[model samples]
Target: MKILTLNFLTCARKACKATNAAFPLHPRDAELEIVETDLNPLFIRNILPRIEWDALREICVELGLPTLPDAAPEPAALFAEPIVPADTMQDADEGAEKQPTQLLQDLHRLLLETTIATGKLVCGNCGHEYAVKEGIANFLLPSHLV
Candidate 1:
């Protein structure tokens, strides 16, 4: 499933449902595939405010991908010289345009291109296993869990 979907998901166990920080369920043994697509800077910018950086960082680490900073990127910081490529920053006039585009490219790769083809999402608190097969995550809980 798309990593973007994880942003909206949380642990299904009744007890864990209310604990927002621990969830979106953590993927384990994930087999990832990257399907490149055109970047959408606007969409990335729109969703930036809603992303949970820590959870995303954990998921990235689980998927054996590069981790985002320990602290979340402020919306404004995305356009800063550090994130914008050095070449882009060299041309001050083009830096503004390039920064957002670069940031969009990165976010697009993370949230859309990366796919989990096989794995299970384990609840951080409850230890529930949600199987993912052929890119589809089965989130159904056992009767006891329900």
Candidate 2:
């Protein structure tokens, strides 16, 4: 499963629905794979506001990945230094081309290129383990857990 997906997922158990600890399921014995993917700066920038920075940082630490910044970066920081200010330019001939900064590329690699080939995502609140295989996460809850 992609790290990006974790932002929206939580413990499947109903009782853990409103719990603060249910989010950003902890990955255990994770087998990571690098799957190169196209970078989409616009999408990342748009979704930045919704990302849980602390949760993501925790996940990174648990997975033994590189640590992220303490705070989420502002959208404007994702782009390269433009010779011309964005507001003063047009889409085509009038503007300096906008490029993604190194940080943006790093975020793309961390969030999209990285995948879990096989692992268990354990919920902190309910102590439930969700299996991930072949990069697909199984969020199904058994009857008792449901």
Candidate 3:
């Protein structure tokens, strides 16, 4: 499986610029990295709810990646599983009606901090496989793929 891990610093910088938001923490170039994994059904099932499916699909298509089923039954089935941490659970209990800050933190960790150390990361929209090698992503695409 191909693995693709993005330089989080680069992504955040681009995002900040695009949204006109101040850069958080003045991150150095390539300092904070965001890695995308070529995950199996199981891993995808675990991550579906946390992910923005439309955005994921768009990225995948942009990268010429393989497409998944339009309806992910496995992910739906696994939605009830507690992907959040114990602290998040406590926070939820404390404020039943309010948004759980811990939950958001956990989501951030899963989506941004985790590294795609192994496996492939295909773009859902583009069907491109951004292979990861030695902690670097090979985003290069042939003319046809592009």
Candidate 4:
């Protein structure tokens, strides 16, 4: 599953849902894979507000992925500043549109390209482990857990 999915997932157990620790499920023995995808800056910009910055950082630390910034970047930072110099005044329209930046590419790698091929996602609150295999996570709780 994508890291984006993991960031939003909490403990399956209803009891743990209300707890602070349950939101960022801890991955154990994760087999990570890189699945390349086209970067969608508009999509990223739209989804930025919904992403939990701290939880994403914590998950990255757990998976030994590259560290994210201390704080999530502002939406405006996703686009490169249009560099229309006064010297090269020709084709001003070409530089007028915003372009995706390195930060956006980095975010695309983390949120969309990275995947957990196999792992166990353990809840911080209840210690219930959700098995992940073949990039699919089993979130169905047994009757005992339900």
Best by lDDT: 4
Residue runs of model 1 more than 4 Å from their true location after superposition:
20-22, 77-99
Summarize candidate 4's per-residue lDDT along 31-128 as a digit string, tens digits.
Answer: 99999998888998888889999999989999999888899999889998777777766877776768888898899889999999999999999999
What does the lDDT read for residue 98 in candidate 2?
75
Give the range where candidate 1 is weakest over 10 consecutive residues by summed lDDT. 77-86
- The better-scoring model by TM-score among 2 and 3 is 2
Report the Cα lDDT for candidate 2: 0.88
The numbered model that scores best in TM-score is 4
> Model 4: how far is 136 from its true place, Å?
0.8
Model 4: pairs clashing at backbone N, Cα or C within 3 Å: none
Worst 10 residues of 2 by lDDT: 88-97
Q: Worst lDDT window (10 residues) for model 3?
A: 20-29
Give TM per candidate: 0.78, 0.89, 0.30, 0.90
* Candidate 4: segments with Cα more than 4 A from true spot: 83-94
lDDT of 3 by residue, 35-118 (tens): 544424344445545544444444344444455346433334433434556666777654343232443333334444454444
Clashes (backbone N, CA, C under 3 Å), per candidate, total 0, 0, 25, 0
TM-score ranking from best to worst?
Answer: 4, 2, 1, 3
**What TM-score quantifies how close candidate 4 is to the native fold?**
0.90
Better of 1 and 2 by lDDT: 2
Ranking by lDDT: 4, 2, 1, 3
lDDT of 4 at 141: 92
- In candidate 3, stretches whose alpha carbon ends up further than 4 angstroms from where it belongs are 1-100, 124-127, 143-146
